[model samples]
Target: MTRRILENSKVLITGGAGFIGSNLTETLLNQNNQVTVLDNFSTGKMENLLPFFSRKNFRLIVGDIRDLDRCREAVQGQEYVLHEAALGSVPRSVKDPMTTTAVNVLGFVNMLYAAQKAGVKRFVYAASSSTYGDSVSLPKVEEQIGRPLSPYAITKYTNELYAENFHALYGIDTVGLRYFNVFGRRQDPDGVYAAVIPKFVKSLLEHKSPTINGDGSFSRDFTYVENVVLANQLALLAEAPEAVNQVYNIASGERMTLNELFFCLRDNLAAFDLEIGKVNPVYGPVRAGDIPHSQACIEKAKARLGYAPVFDVRSGLREATKWYFENL
Candidate 1:
């Protein structure tokens, strides 16, 4: 935590108008770093980029990563690239695999090629927990992986492979953070592919019951956005040779069942509106392509990238609830 932070330099964040990318944009802007955002506004929101519009250090290109020219334009003179653009959602991929692969896999190579050709110092991208697909390991480690259960998982694993190839062949420094179930502010809760936490919080705020996609026994290692922002910053500046061209599990190193997550969100929301306490979760059949449980062994990130997540599950839920109470 004591190393230098990214500042006074140029940075490009693809999908910078999305939840995690916007947070990263905000943090770097505060440091006075010149930040450029390239987004197609497909899944990313214009509202997330609204706060940064007036900042002098902020630049936005209304473009898609699937476009090689746009990717090249976004990476020009950039010292680092944070690739966060993708169509995320297992069920969504199940329904439509073609669009997902086009964006996640094809779009990823476009960005990486652009960054490599630009001679960017570091290429830090958002990898996924879904890459550890079908593996029954309690706490997921980087080395072990199983067959992908969904197209979304396949796309993410493809990202890791491409990143490795780019580093070995082209010598562009790269780091992939296999993010867990990340949740926090500015996350859109209205979409069909919305994350569970924000969607559940929105439902409770509206005094409606949220549906848990399974029997509520399935668990995940939910990470806060701030921790992810920190990880990206560290990965961008990490000088360790072992850290580059590698993927690390970025999480709180904790796990909570869906039933537990429901109650936690309920309890936190009830603090503002007492009626939220009465809202319960309705049970549904297990979701397709979802693992039974997931947790992260974060020792690799801790040792290599100096990653230490400051927000645990309840605390992150508390902050997220507060934001939802005020905004939604």
Candidate 2:
């Protein structure tokens, strides 16, 4: 992939104190860009952004995207916007659909309008694999998406719609990234809504048996956080007009079953502590609003934005396990 210098460019990253957002902030700052983070700390942790507080180019605006005034203020004078702030999780959305819609859908539109008004050069936001709801396809393509299975899926799909409309009507360039099961370092593992990888890693490290929600048949295309960061960079810097105003699946183009994921984590964590290998996973009922399988056809992203994922699931798991072992 061609590396574009974003040095000295003013960039705003919503949810910068969260998992993916913090990683993006680190990457952009390494490239010498001026980075500003807008986060509510409702779900985002301040520890993620604390490392950058002393950086001359890093600024933090403690606020929520649900607030339009905060969104407007965050986008002002920013050349690029990476909108990653949203209440994520199927169960959480199911429990509180009203709050989810207000934050994900309403907040997204506010950001779009704010970016438009501020004349931001490019607006890239987090879309989701959940939007591929109920489609029993092996490899999910960008054009074909099924009806949203949950409130979270609907909100993400709505963001795509609003983004496309913003690009067409306001002439603002936009790219939506439909991320698969993204996992990596610093992913929170304490919460009930924690992602599988981090949550399982935490359990295994504690020598506790992590429960699989199904019979271990469920699967997902687990993309690494660095790969997601690469896709964001490509979305922001891609010179092709066709790449803009489009959504791309950011993934490793591979899938892993929960059973396989379990063993992979077990074996990797066991390398650090032999006792962890003996802890077998407990099986449970399948989760509501969960599809049987999910995989992404990333050719659209490759052809359009030159996105090539550097780490596959196994490679990413190896790195992630090492980080969790060290940090947790």
Clashes of 2: 0
lDDT of 2: 0.93
Find the 10 residues in a row with the least total lDDT in model 1: 1-10
Residue range 148-217, candidate 2, lDDT tens digits = 9999999999999999888789899999999999999989999989999998998988888999998999
**Candidate 2 lowest-lDDT run of ten:** 1-10
Clashing pairs in 2: none
Which residue pairs collide, candidate 1?
Answer: none
Q: Where does candidate 2 stray beyond 4 Å?
A: none
lDDT of 1 at 142: 96
Question: Model 1 residue 310 lDDT?
Answer: 78
- CA lDDT of each prediction against the hidden true structure: 0.93, 0.93
